[model samples]
Target: MKVAYWPGCVSRGFTPELHGSMALVGPRLDLEMVELNRANCCGAGVIAEHNQELVDTLNARTFALAQQTGASMMNICSTCQGAQSECQQRLDADDAYREHINTHLEPEGLRYEKGGDWSNKNLLWLLVEEIGLDKLRERVVRPLDGLRVAPFYGCYIVRPTGRLGYDRFPHRDKYLEHVIETVGGTAVEYAGSHKCCGFPVITMAKATSLRQAGRHLADAIDADADCLVTPCPLCHLNLDLQQPDAAKYVERDLNIPVLHLPQMLGLAFGLDPKELGMDKHVVKTRDVQRKVAELAAA
Candidate 1:
């Protein structure tokens, strides 16, 4: 019931609503989430690709903070989960890397006491495992009756099961849809739900990111989804923020609303539009908000 949550850099800044909504929604589902006092980046940004040592040291800081809670850690960012997920395999297989990581933390007097390595959990797993479907079903204030949601998995979040085991349960749509159902929403079956969302190719080349994103969007739109949702902020960036650029590259316009799973859940929990931070996104949530209001009224 008690767990620590790590909201990676983007979630802290651009996706405040998702984080805020998690705090609001988790407790209602009987999860007592303890946020790390000084939750920092999980050493993901460019460190993971360029420097292994820096990645370890940087992430050790987050581990150090989560260990402070003395409870299992639940994570919001898929990339952060991937980093921590990756370290799980290292800490288990290579004592040298693990010890060196801990040694780096010694100067700060922070020790990595491993009864087990960080219990890196994704929000979906936490809901399915920690809070059962029955409890989820009990929380529905507004059901997504007519809405068909497209679940986007992207990549890092679901691969390499060293963390949330999302790979084992590789259906991103179902989890969001489950919560959607709890609030009376229909989790519409759709194609492109498990596509990569172009995370790897995004920053490497604009063309690559564009083509990949446009294709993914085009597929989702073609599937007749009312809205697209994802747990990963990076995926949200590509699928939501970069859609305009992607559309230009593909030479087509897509007005599809990309919803962060928590943002949708927060609205169902009766959170105000401001509390969900719906305005900060590239695509407006006004129509989505109207639908929710209509659903609740109905």
Candidate 2:
């Protein structure tokens, strides 16, 4: 089972280990991962908000690359997966956008396939469906030992409502929570778990973004969560890097450490701090690492 891996821009820079974690665990789950050697940015929020042509082109090019591999594509970022899946949906429905994109690529002899939803899978969907909670259970060498996590969805993972295409999952925070529990960690529910992280507003108005991020941070911190974990890179960026600023601006100590979903899952499997790249993150997950070590020692 080989699949094309799309790391997107943020994961390439900010959450580098996510791909590494996937590489480490992919084979264990019977997946052979092949990264798109020529992949570029998924246009983040640019093409979607600004140029429809480029959005079509960006997603089409990625599908073209995946076709080059003769394999389906799986993405690590919630934003990228959402973008690609959205583009796929649009291409699947509208013939005009599809032909326009394929024409742009025709100079290079590339084209989007007809009558096909470009094969794309989000990690959340893959983990729940492909990995199976039962299989995830057998691999838990290290239990989270009661460190509570606030299951933060923050929009992208479960959007357009019905695209996830699975049973009774209802496209909610419960999917990631279920996976988290299999690794022995409790997914704490809170008020702001489904709210936006103010990622789009961050660039235009810093205050609005900080206010929104702080509100979410306060909820997780107020819940006494040891960490805030989510699958979106933008959410990780906003919640982790912006919290200190948001805290001061909001006049409260959020002091909450943020973890990428993969980072937390890696820890739950006893992968250790170095292997998980905990020290390199903006939040410096070292304290969480120390807590785990101390608890393990006792």
Candidate 3:
């Protein structure tokens, strides 16, 4: 399966490792990812809070790129997926808005068709539906047998169907767990699996965001999860980068390591941790790597 990849702004700027790991893992799964050329940010969710029209125009350009690529555009970041996909739906449904966006695209020789034959897929959804869990299992050279990974599906990626978008078919909450099991790891249940990681409010409400993230970490610790895995780079940031603050907020030393989904899958694919850029994480992946080695030995 081939798709155009949009790594999004934050992942390109703050989490290049996510892209690195995906590039490594995709070939193993028979998934060919071509990075979308001249693609821009898909509003990052925060932009809509300030300017809705700007968000629509910017994301319409992104869709035009996907349309030009001839394959559906795939996003590694949850916010980018949500923003662009929601914008696509909006532009398709609203005639006046579509015309307005097209007027902006006309100068660049790009025109977004209201009935455009393209899709904006999230990586998690692409893996589960397109690649199939059995195919993913077949690519697992080193099964992560005995590892308990807690799946974290941060806020924006999964919802607002009742608000602004459509419901994710086949249920999105199970996508992470499916990928975890496909790589031979146990997906442990935790309260924060479906809760927000508090990333969206991090800028405006730092204390509240830390407390919320702390609550999720506390849940994961209680569940005895070895580490947390997330599809969203922003969620990874909140749970991984803000871990220190979260520990202070909860008044406990939460030593849990966080892994981007691709990084965790790379370990199962028998790729080197260094190649996956595991060391760049705020929370170390050394322990996770050590555990994977032991699992391979067993």
> TM-score winner among the candidates?
3
lDDT string, candidate 2, 1-298, tens digits: 6888877777777667666676666665677888887877777666788987788787898888888787778887878877776777777778887887899888877777855444677666778866677887787777887878887775766776665443446644578788778878878877888788888788899898888889988888788888878888788888887878888767897778888777777776777767776776666676688877875676
TM-scores of all predicted structures: 0.89, 0.92, 0.95
Model 1 C-alpha RMSD to native: 2.5
* Candidates ranked by TM-score: 3, 2, 1
Q: Could you tell me the lDDT of residue 207 within candidate 2?
A: 90
Q: lDDT: which candidate is best? A: 3
**For model 3, what is the alpha-carbon lDDT of residue 244?**
92
Cα shift from native, residue 186, model 3 (Å): 0.6
* Prediction 2 global C-alpha lDDT: 0.77
Each model's lDDT comes to 0.72, 0.77, 0.83
lDDT tens per residue, model 3, 190-279: 888988888888889988898889888889989999999988999888899899988898888887888998898899989998999888
lDDT for each residue of candidate 1 in 4-105, tens digit (9 for 90 to 100): 877777777766767777777777777777878576677654677787777777777777777888888888777777777676555656777788888888
Pairs that clash in candidate 1:
140-182, 142-183, 143-183, 143-184, 143-185, 144-184, 144-185, 144-186
